[model samples]
Target: MTPGLINGHLHVSQHLLRGFVPLAVSDTSAYLFKWVFPYYETLTSREEGVAATLAGCDLLTKGVTMVADGGTVRHPGVVADALATTGIRAHLGGWSWDHASAPPGLSMDTTEALDRLSGAMDEVAGRHPRIAPLATTIGLGMSSDALLEGAKSLADRHGTFLDFHHSFDAGEVESHRSSFGDDVTPVEHLERLGILSDNVRLVHQIVSTAAELDAIQRTGASVVRCTGTRAARDLAELRGRGIPVGVGTDTVNVSNTSDVLRALHVFAAEIREPDSDIPSSGLSADDLFDMCTVGGARTLGVASFAGSLEPGKSADLVMFDALRPEWIPMIDPVNQLVLSADGGSVESVWIEGELVVDRGRVIGVDELALCQEAEEAAAGVLMRMGARARIGRRSLC
Candidate 1:
């Protein structure tokens, strides 16, 4: 058994839109502005609550006891209360953005953005041990330099970490170059703004460079790899350099599942570089396991309690059934876990010594009811969005 896994970065609010992003959203920009942000602009409190609960249920059955929200969740109190019903720990990043890319309804000026973020953080503080507010702007691509600095200041004032998506794809990197500077990479631009620090966290940091790696190393920032194999190679380098690394399955809209085991499958098998003889990550299954557990806890700033089963730590553990066919020769537990297992094998899950999941089902949550509610919620929310009429136009189907 191991400590319950931590999904280092995710958008719980995006769960309603899972499997709905059109096939034509070929890049991060489109994924955000076209699909993601439009949904965010129109999401309702009821939808947010249901989505967070469903997201918590998905993570709990998959052996995740805690998660870090990727921001853009417009309703933290609603989402937090819903997640609390499932006994999951969370750090929420309420949305903050002041950029032209944002829909007018969702946009805010720098001062307005900072005020809203600060209010959200304060609004959730001391309310629950497991639920928290993370100072977050969606990313540099949607936030101006002034908003970035202001968000960092909120994190500092609140004595918590700041997080955002950064350098996710080629288009995003180019946008940074045009907005920040042509000469410096996006990471350098953040460094130039004094935004990189030990307390700062980043997600979707796919673009890598020697200087970027150097900056991340020097600033003591943490990175959570949220998507595909491109970041897999850099993850090995990040870990080798003693930089903390964590794993996430991204949004179901993008990856279709929040299962870390699925993320592991992508990491271990597809981590090797194409058209190259040498393996990109040279990491063993055991290393990968650590990244999922303790390393992830550390990256999310919860290692003091939630990451491991050590003495004085929080009681969070996942037990896999050994009688399954895949475990016939379970000589190596880690290998069995990494290679042959999925959420189906998870027999039970506990958080704070309380039984939360048993027989691969989440207690106190009705899968059928929640799913139906989500279906209704998604339909209602999307139906009101002006972007709804523009949807089927993009899908190849």
Candidate 2:
């Protein structure tokens, strides 16, 4: 038994984008301007609601007790309501960017953007005890200076973390660099804006440099590495610096599944580019397990109350079926969990003493009906999107 997994970063509004990406999608820029933005602009409230419920159901069944959203582009209130029904704890925030690079109908004026996120915070409040609202941004490259500063202030006022995407892929790295003339790194830019404090959960650290990693460690900001679109690179280096780190599934479009255990299995397979400063032998199964549970809770800033199987902490537990092949003999629990077992072995899950998942199926919702609604919702959005998405896609690229 363990504290349920925490997806330290998630894109709640992009759930329905799964399985619909046009074949042969390119890097981040094309992905953002062509597909993700268009889908966000066209998604209806009902579609977002169904997607949120679907995401929550999948997460709970996969032993995810807490999820911190990257940001939502549409009706965040509807998404909140749907997750509330699934009984999963979450950290949510709205998305708005003022950069000219932001697609049409997505960007807002500086003040309007800040106000919109603040309003989203208000809307999420009192919705559920487990659902918290925080400050968020699309990405550093797509956010203006004022927006970053404003988000920091908002997070300070709320005493919460500001979840934002930073260096992930090469395209995003170059784009953020083009806006600055100085030789300073990305983390340095945040330092100049007074944004790289303890109240930040920086997502997608694939492109971070040694200097940037130093800055992150110095500032006490946590890192949430997404294993969906990229391999788990330099995770040991992050831990070597004593930086709090967690793992996430990122977006459904790229990930296709929110199962963190399976995500880690893929992560273990794709591990490469180890730093020389770290151990010659890379991460172990136990280390991966820690990242999914307690380390994730710390990254999401809920460690004081949850994340471990302790007496004073919240009651969140995952019970696996020992009779399953994955748990057979149980010679090494951590090894079996991180390397062999999938989420299917999860027999039940308890979040805050509430039985949300029972006997390998989520409770309080018809599994058949949910899948049917998801299919209908996805179909509805795909029809409106026209050639932007199709059913015969081979790769999201």
Off by over 4 Å in 1: 272-281, 386-397
TM-score of 1: 0.92
Error of 1 at 21 (Å): 1.1
Model 1 Cα lDDT, one tens digit per residue, 252-298: 98768888877877776666447643356568888888777998888
lDDT of 1 at 280: 61
How much lDDT does each candidate structure score? 0.81, 0.81
TM-scores for all candidates: the values are 0.92, 0.93
Candidate 2, backbone clash total: 0
- What global local distance difference test value does model 2 have? 0.81
**Which runs in model 2 stand beyond 4 Å of their true positions?**
22-24, 228-230, 272-282, 388-397
lDDT of 1 at 176: 75
Clash pairs (backbone) in predicted model 2:
none
lDDT of 2 by residue, 247-320 (tens): 88888766667888877887777663353332425678877777888898888778887788988888999988
